[model samples]
Target: MLLNPLLSLSRSPSVLQRPSSLLRPLSSSNLPPIQGGSSSPSLYCRSLVQRLDHDAFLTSYFWPAGRKKDAFFALRAFNIELASIQETVSNPAIGRMRLQFWRDAVRDLSNGLPPPLHPIPLLLSQTTTPSTRDLTAYYLNQIIDAREANLLDPPPPTLTSLLTTLSTTSTPLHLLSLSLLTPTPPAYITSSVQHLSLSIGLTNLLRALPFHLSRRRAVGLPLDLCAKERVVMEKVFRIASGKEGGEGGLSQVKGLREVVWEVAVRANDELMTARRELELEGGTGFPVGKEFMPVFLSAIPARSYLQRLEQLDGDAFDPSLQRRHWRVPLDVWLAWRRGRF
Candidate 1:
């Protein structure tokens, strides 16, 4: 999943200044050394998550501190690393080699063997104890397998294909996060988490479009939607490359807004379904446990980003979309206070 650059801690000093012990200074000296060093894996995890996935780092503050929180960071760090493989490696075989390492790592972690000298796996080994079984090899391997499958695979041909990619890549994250908080979350919670995962996954794909285009990777947007909307991929690349710009610049690209609108609408539908699931489970007065709210809080950023995109009339290329919404932290805090996501 692509991270929204808007919620980055580097861009928002006000978010960084929030008074919480969980918010550590994002300086290297304060974080632990990398893998194989004698340092707390939690610190390494926290540092890695903050640097690579700031939104995850920001949402992670909602999780209770200690082992549960640390486990959440470890899981996010693992995901961030895997998500980053496409950008890091030039060759598909090299990416597979890396994925193979993680596959072996997960297998070892589940078998109670000494994990390889990696901070994320080591931290996971310590927190996901056999007694608790909080994190499972099944979920970890699902994520790796999906990432491996995506290595040389072409862009999704349809929306169904896109959701299938998310079902494995994103769904497992929510399940694993919920498991860290409670061994068995209510069925409603599980269902809602699944919906939220897809919602966020779609939103992230939109947010990352600019970044992907810069690298000539037109992967997240489905081929069917592009065909239906007459969205010329070459035109999109020219616009992104600044080769097609003047007055009425982005508008020159045909059917792009329609494609964006379709994607955003799907994201909103998933988000609303998640909310409706919660309401149906307990009516309007459902009791939101503190333990459960952290998982729900992730919805705040996704909802906020989607709302802002809608305000711009689904203009994905709008420069305003790149900046952090000043109210996000306040919105998150207010949602937390009201016992809602």
Candidate 2:
């Protein structure tokens, strides 16, 4: 899905109007039956998420088997569906149309019905009971609105605007995942969850930057941060996308590495804050239970990614940072056992 095109310093700061919050009546009866996908419900969602995005697969790999995996796969499948739009579509207008379709689909799901035209929402609906769907309906639609908000990239954002962008686009998914893991989520940890989710969202935004610029020729870096380091968008796009092929692409930019470090430091602060909040002692948040572990495991990838960014010395276009590192499985395993991520 189009990430929060980050709150651009040059762009207008218009917030998304939530259709879910508006309380408009929905005529879900007109929703069509799911069509076109041959895979079974769970299998379809599972395969879709795995093929398109393996991070969630690794995160959910540690979850206790059965219903939890099914539910999370459905959730990540929907996320992948939204995330792929900007990368795959050549035209922004077509992307908008597809996003509108998903907006409608989420509304239908909120009404205890999912559009039959798409397998993702259909399978997601089936994975959970109607009552469970009802509870998650608001957050579900929020994600659609977040995707819709960023369909057209605006100006580079301020740090505040960037975080707000993520609070909607990313934070809700974490909350929903936690809900899926346990019906009775701890009330006090909402702040911690929001912190961790926002941090992960920012980290992913950084990870996806090269892709965003390469696929669409647009940079999503917060404008304020880019300014402090005088990052040049066009050069960054070429280098990060590997279109620039001298030995040292990172050296081409004047301050790209420093810009990346600024963002990384902010992300690191958020990550450490989340860890403290989730700490079992002298912390404001609750202890993470084994059942709740999978939802929080996202921190592992975020941290590993940050470390990689550091390794590259903040060169946003470094080739070594593009591929998955060898130490990821070990990082994930250690995080799982320690309940630290």
User: How high a TM-score does candidate 2 get?
Assistant: 0.81
Q: Estimate each model's TM-score.
A: 0.87, 0.81
What Cα-based lDDT does every candidate model obtain?
0.76, 0.67
**Candidate 1 structure lDDT:** 0.76
Question: Under the 3 Å rule for N, CA and C atoms, how many clashes does model 1 have?
Answer: 0
Clashing pairs in 2: 1-82, 1-83, 7-157, 8-155, 8-156, 8-157, 9-156, 33-116, 34-116
Query: Best candidate, TM-score-wise?
Result: 1
Give the poorly placed runs of model 1, Cα more than 4 Å off: 1-38, 132-135, 245-247, 281-287
Q: 84 in model 1: Cα distance from truth in Å?
A: 0.9
lDDT value, residue 145 of candidate 1? 92
Which stretch of 10 consecutive residues in model 2 shows the poorest summed lDDT?
Answer: 16-25
Q: Give RMSD (Å) of candidate 1 vs. truth.
A: 5.9
Question: Mind giving the per-residue lDDT tens digits that candidate 2 earns over 1-341?
Answer: 42222112114222211111111112223222333363577777766554445457567677767877878877887887777676567777899899888777777777776456566777767767877877677887888787777777675579889888888878888898988888876664656778888788777767755555655445567888787788777766677677876456645577766777777888899887777766544443444667777877777767888887787677656655555555565666666777667
Model 1 reaches what TM-score against the true structure? 0.87
